[model samples]
Target chain A: MSLRERYGGMTRAEQGVSLFVCGFTALLVVALLTGGLTPSYTLYLAGLTGMYVLLSLGLNAQWGYTGLINFSVAAFFGLGAYGAALVTASNSPLAIPGGVLVGLVLAVVGSAVVATAIAIPTLRLRADYLAIASLGLAEVVRQIVLNQRDWTNGSGGLRGIPDVFAGWPVLGPLPGELPGLQFAEYAVGIPGLFRIRVLGFTLGEPFWTDLLNFVAVVVFVAAVYLLLRRVHRSPWGRVLRTIRSDEELASALGKDTYAFKLQSFVLGSVVMALGGVFYAYLVAYVDPGDLEPINTFYVWIAVILGGSGSNRGAMFGGFVVVAIREGTRFASDILPARLPVDVPVLVDVYGAIVSDFGSTRLLIVGLLIVLVMRLRPEGVLPPQRELLWPSALEETDE
Target chain B: MALLELLANGLVFSSIIVLASIGLSLVYSIADFANFAHGDTMAVGAYAALLAFGVIGGVGPTVLALPVGFFLSLAVGGAVAALVAVITHVLVYEPLEVDSIGLLITSIGVAFVYRAIIQLRFGSNPVEFGIPLQRPIDALVPLGIRITVHEIAIVASAAILVVGLHLLLQYTDLGRKMRATADNPSLARVAGIRTRRIEWWTWIIGAGLAGVGGGFLGLYNQLSPRMGFDILLVVFAAVILGGIGSVYGAMAGGLLIGVINQLMPAISNVAVALPLVPNVGPAYADTVAFLIMVAVLLVRPSGIAGGETT
Candidate 1:
């Protein structure tokens, strides 16, 4: 059977595998919780992973699905985070919700405007130039943001922003106490058995912010996944795929490729911006340093790892990639202090030799990308469809 | 006097930029890929020069160090560039069969690898040349224009290199081969030209020039791991503005950008003097080159000289 046919035939098995994976993941989480893992650290990692996944999905929408090369995803994300920070930092209550809404709106509008403006002059240029131009534009945005002290507070950064769910209690169900879910008081039975207090209202600590952020991310991802999946199966999606496969053919058929690309750019940018806004709320601070070009590549790695064109793949990619990064740090922290002398020396020497290795994660990431492109270009979770999608669709086509 | 000083400073800066950009433009034009590691190659040159100076020892050692530094830098840069070109071609570009966009992304990865290695060795700190030059020229020149001997040497070397490159490209058989390879690699190959050899030569020449530029820059402004990366954007802007693939254009673009960047802030008061608008001072001049680049890009996507799109 053909590869496509084989893949299609495995749908039921794939579902079962996914179920098993989910179960296994839950079991692992439970084990960690019971095994005395730092709750705050775990929560923080979960929130970060969720954010990365959101970003990866956004990028996948543009790059994998639409075949649009977006080198400025991080810039959009940064813009949203900064926008959220600016709004939340304001004393006005209207600014809080308004800030998030405004952040998302501006991110979409601004990215669209920039994309449109650039496309007019550069769309005809070779694709590579477009990539360069986009990269340059991202840098320009970063510099502008950095230079605009009056608005962005410059590089010193904006701090002490009000959290979206600040007044909410930690380790509790939503604001209202739900019936049939009693707060379990902490009790130790056998080594593995433990009960924790939940329900009602216990503020506990600031950890609730992270939990809320994770929930927010999950909801957002679900909504986007459903929306994108629908679009991917639509007639417009077919046209987008055609455009990706052959732009000239798409344009020959009277489709305006420029308009389609602009739409995709705007939509992907908006999603990234939303992720940024959520990230700001999670961190409670926004800084220029947080929005480096490296962040864009990180998202790229996630998308590529998961499966570029697949929404599910993007989510998986983001989670796995973030987990690896955060898990490495945790490993470093928790690893045994005393090893064989020779081994310790080797580790120390290697660490010193690759002192910039941490920052050089991009290099590692690049190598991984190269390896993926070579060995498994389809990625770990290949998209269901063979055809690539165009970034834009005519309103009539839709 | 201050105006003259600024002009002189701008000229010196422009010379350095031109030296750096021309090599970048050549590599991009010929290889059809942006060597993201180009900046690090420059850093390598600076470090090589430092090593040479350290080995030679004494006041006169710097004078002797220039050629040794330049040649060593050229060798190192060429070797690294060629190795990376081959590796990238095999690992990244060939597999994807994607266009230069994919290659460029891969180049970013390669650049980081080179940067990490450099940082591993150099510890990311700035290193000074610390060569004390005689002040006869500085004292003799009017307008408080203090052009050190090192600066003079840099200017002289840059002029020589530019002229030499122009001649080689215009008059040499190798230059013709490179041009042919750049214009149509398949056609060149069909004509029995060894495209791979031409590419190797192109990388060697281009990277060598970058190395020299880096070494000179190290002399002028402290040698740091980031120095090359920081200046890379400006160099790229110069390359694009001048028109990609045009060496002369790159040089001209570099000098024009450098001068405009310096002169704009000086003339900021002119805008204020003309109308009701208040003067924006020199603080924003740092962004002048980038603004010009953006404006130029908007106006002419193919660039000022109108060669390649990027």
Candidate 2:
């Protein structure tokens, strides 16, 4: 479909969201062109956003589709990261010979096992039980990772992890083999010393590597999205939704809700681990800190705010999270350094805030969660289209 | 002798856990959601006490090595925490139209907001009360028990509060009404008991106890923005063990978990004594606690107290 046709099909809210997204993208590109932001940094941010999108999508499966409150998003993600890192990283104690392939398989498989183990006991209880249990279990996993020096290298973390395309034929050598491209610097409407140098950016090895990572994530996200779309419109997906809305009704229909819930939990967890697999390659590092509960909440915000049970919303929320994270860091750096005001008390207040921007980020995250739940519980772009199997819908029309 | 010392340490830690778990259990059933912010409420109380200490400035005599001002600050902390929780309930929770799960998720956000504000003001680094650290009592040295006066004070205060809560639940009109409401809110309303008023009272009594517990926790260790959050899982474990929404069970669960947590070294020693078992360290304390919670869920979902409220 053409851009105009797509725009025409969107609701007013969707249209507004699309326009805002476009505006933001354009501004980001402009910033890159003006040398205000580096190309490599922008690509890195995009890569992180893609990782988050994968996580949000994983969560959307459990929470949006089945209403399973699996708070172990971080746990699964960590397992995936550790899985890949252990087999692939140079510092790994039990480094396997199969490289990235082993890592990817291990990640998904490990997460599936953990998810199943967790689901068995908790899925039998109330919904909130899973939330509380998963959180505690996540902590348990992190502790094991932190203390198991023989296996995980303890808190020192694994490093020297190869890129995702390290063993690929052409792509393996792409980053190093690619030539550096530099844009000619131009003075923008100012005298020599005071001039802003626009278009002086260089696309080098780091940029190429980040771009490759971004491309891999794009492909991963696309594949997952198509798969989720198919599953979400199926009769099975309908049963899951039935369970989410009312478990008793689903049970009355002779559907085994526990098995369905367990399946959903494992599937979402594996997907989350896949995201972590990508993350291990993207950052080329893995640590216990990566499993922090805050990361889980970040994805939670993305899923809920973007619109629960909406694939596009999950994607949108993922991008917004990166914005919140890096935007705060950027603001903290720039705002404090160039405070034009000379007032003492004002300076002190501003200085204090910018000095510890971590707290500000936390506050923003907290407030956003509350505001989103309070103001728009359905989220920004709740599933607009009724989900039905394509063939079933067509038969009904006939 | 070493085991005895561990027992002593466990009792001290159990007092704080009991204080935290009781409030969480009370809120869990009555409020009809696991208040994730309940942990942060403890942090709020601790900080309030810290602030009150700053203002009170160790004025007057010291009791059990804690200044009279410290007790006043502890009271202030409890009051402030209750006030903050009531304000949050009125503003955030009461206004929002959502189910128990929604409230649970929102409470996570509430928790973050509380921690963030505390971190923003005090910075993230841990800080101790102005109260000087007390050495283990000279009298208990020969007995191999390294207990401090501050610890004794914590146990005493917690015991008093727990007893007070017991009396309130058993004898007071508000207590009876609170129990009736917890058992069945609609029925209580039909019976002319104002459930809303009871909920507020629950918040007051529950959060008030948590605040005092938090104050004692600060005395036991140091205060940080994440202090309560860090211990949240353990408290949750206690509540789940006692049975969620069961106040008396929370007390029993808290004591058991606390003792078990402190006795980690001894447990590891026992493990070492057994063939094919590896020795573990204190680092696995939370891990062990969580595992126990999972075990409890598997064995007795209703909890040790059989899932009865209050």
Model no. 1, DockQ: 0.40
- Per-residue alpha-carbon lDDT of candidate 2 for residues B1-310, written as tens digits (9 for 90 to 100): 6999999999999999999999999998788899999989999999999999999968799888888999999999999999999999999999999999999999999999999989988999999896777899999989999999989999998999899899999999999998998889999999999899889988988898889888889889999999999999999999999998899999999999999999998898788889887667888988899989988988898899998887
Clashes in predicted model 1 = 5
The candidates' DockQ values read: 0.40, 0.81
Residue range A257-340, candidate 1, lDDT tens digits: 877766666667777877887788777788878777778877887887777687777877787677556645555565564443
> Quick one: how many clashes does candidate 2 have?
0
lDDT for residue A23 in candidate 1, whole number 0-100: 75
Task: Report model 2's chain A TM-score.
Answer: 0.92
Residues B214-290 of candidate 1: C-alpha lDDT, one tens digit per residue: 77788778888777777777787787789877777788899988777667656786777888764556755645576
Model 2: clashing residue pairs?
none
